[model samples]
Target: MTEQQRKDYFDKVDKNINEFGYHLTNVFESKERPSFFYSTGIYKSFNLPEIFIPSLPHGLCCEIADNYVKAFKDKRVVPRNEKLQHLSGRFPIFLIDVPTSRLTDYVLSSVWYYKDGNYEYVQVIYPDTQGHFPNDAGYDYDQEILGEFRL
Candidate 1:
């Protein structure tokens, strides 16, 4: 995707977050990945898994979403649960559209765990073909964790 398209896509995502009453608390960007951390005013909001950080609820340090490199070799749509297996612990998960040049469309599901006072973010990229997570299909997935940092 062109630079303008990338900016436009993130703008839309920010707008959606505002519409939902959640606001971004921090943002991190690098050559290989970009991430957004968010929080809501509501009580008992989404939280990260305890295994990742036992002191906080999923919502307190929640990584609302992120984007990562698409590295699937097979090129097929993957089930949500299948993607979750690549994650370390249970927490709420949702898929979001991401801009990509490697595929026609990419859906990224994000979950977070707390580590070293920062959020260890995991994003499972579901491409139209050959998903980017470990699965029964036996495809080799080599991408590393996309982003991690404090909120």
Candidate 2:
């Protein structure tokens, strides 16, 4: 997408988030959820399997929606779109909220492409926070952090 188109897309997504709020419950309930699913051809052609994150219900959608809004507002759509295009339809998305301090020191590569004997899958992890919480086991810094306990 061109730079302007990317910005426009981000703006559109931000408007959606602002109108709907960055609530996962709402994101999931929205009629647009079906579009997020990959086409059978996409999987078959790319050998992309259903992706799964070991973590569950970690509010990754909220983070993504929130980031889109922030990117639009900050006028950072170009870089944002570049990163997003690489991620789009690449992972099924699995997330979990563990204390950052509790997370393992392991590299924890969140996005992976895997294929084995007629099986394939891509996984991606979106952290809710972008701040420095290296001590916490699995705190996402990309989230809005609405409150101490809320992202």
Candidate 3:
């Protein structure tokens, strides 16, 4: 999808999230079930990355990544045995908005394997903390907003 199209799609999700609190973020383009789809929790100037995580309950960052790998291996969006599929492999990608925030302790991790299943590539996108949350709470300053996109 083009940049504009991606922005538009994320905008739609943002609107839905605002109205419904949370929504299922799915990738209908994939032939097999999606291993993982981008999700976000928006509060004020922050847009936190999240996972839909059918097999596991809602969790914080990297908390449900193991479930993501199991789904990828089984080629199923919803794993059959929830109890067994409990381990988070390293994610494939990480995108952080770097220009605005003071860069520090940037780390990238990965796990590689070629298996005939699903989800070949994992995409990680992290926003620049400074760009997203420009001013700290209780600081009167000009309002600034970050670009809207899925991780």
Candidate 4:
């Protein structure tokens, strides 16, 4: 990213967070990793863990993230390891504590935005359309695609 692009990106992140109480950082898929999106400003505003959703389409990730943040804003805290049924229709979403080791890899932007603070965040993993998670008895997906976010 160019110097000007970097400036613009931070400015947009700050603006959105100020106006919407949170912002979504979407990372598109690359040859080495699947796509993922995460929320910034939630922890800042609500003392809630930032959210991360890996290995999903951009639009779906955004929708699920919006719901999660909105619920958090209203004080509906979803416990870690709980399945949030119907939060995304047939595909129930789940949350788990994001290992700090993977933050630099999967959530670099969030890390940068927070200035590498010891803030809390969670990985928002979910099941396939068939409702099977990456580790379920019948889950289906390659470890190469999910990397360290297959929970």
Model 4, which residues run further than 4 Å from truth? 143-151
lDDT of 3 by residue, 1-151 (tens): 7999877766776676577543344333346332333333321112232233221223423344434433343442332212222343322222223221211111100011112221222233322324232223443323222222232
Q: Model 2 off-target regions past 4 Å? A: 1-27, 30-39, 50-118, 131-151
What TM-score does structure 3 among the candidates reach? 0.26
Q: What are the clashing pairs of model 3?
A: 66-87, 66-88, 93-124, 95-124, 95-125, 95-126, 96-126, 97-127, 97-128
Let me know the TM-score candidate 1 reaches against the reference structure.
0.22
Candidate 1's C-alpha runs over 4 A off are 1-21, 30-34, 42-129, 134-151
TM match of model 2 to true structure: 0.23
- lDDT by residue (tens digit), candidate 1, 79-150: 223334322233332222222222111112112111123222233333222442333355464432232211
Q: For residues 20-110, could you state the per-residue lDDT of candidate 2 as single tens digits?
A: 4321222122452221211111123322232223222435433443343343434422231012432323232222223322212211111
The alpha-carbon deviation from the true structure for residue 132 of candidate 4, after best TM-score superposition, in angstroms, is 1.7
The whole-model lDDT of each prediction reads 0.30, 0.30, 0.32, 0.73
> Model 1, 84: alpha-carbon shift in Å?
7.3
- The true-versus-predicted C-alpha distance at residue 81 of model 4, in Å, is 0.9
Best by TM-score: 4
State TM-scores per candidate: 0.22, 0.23, 0.26, 0.85
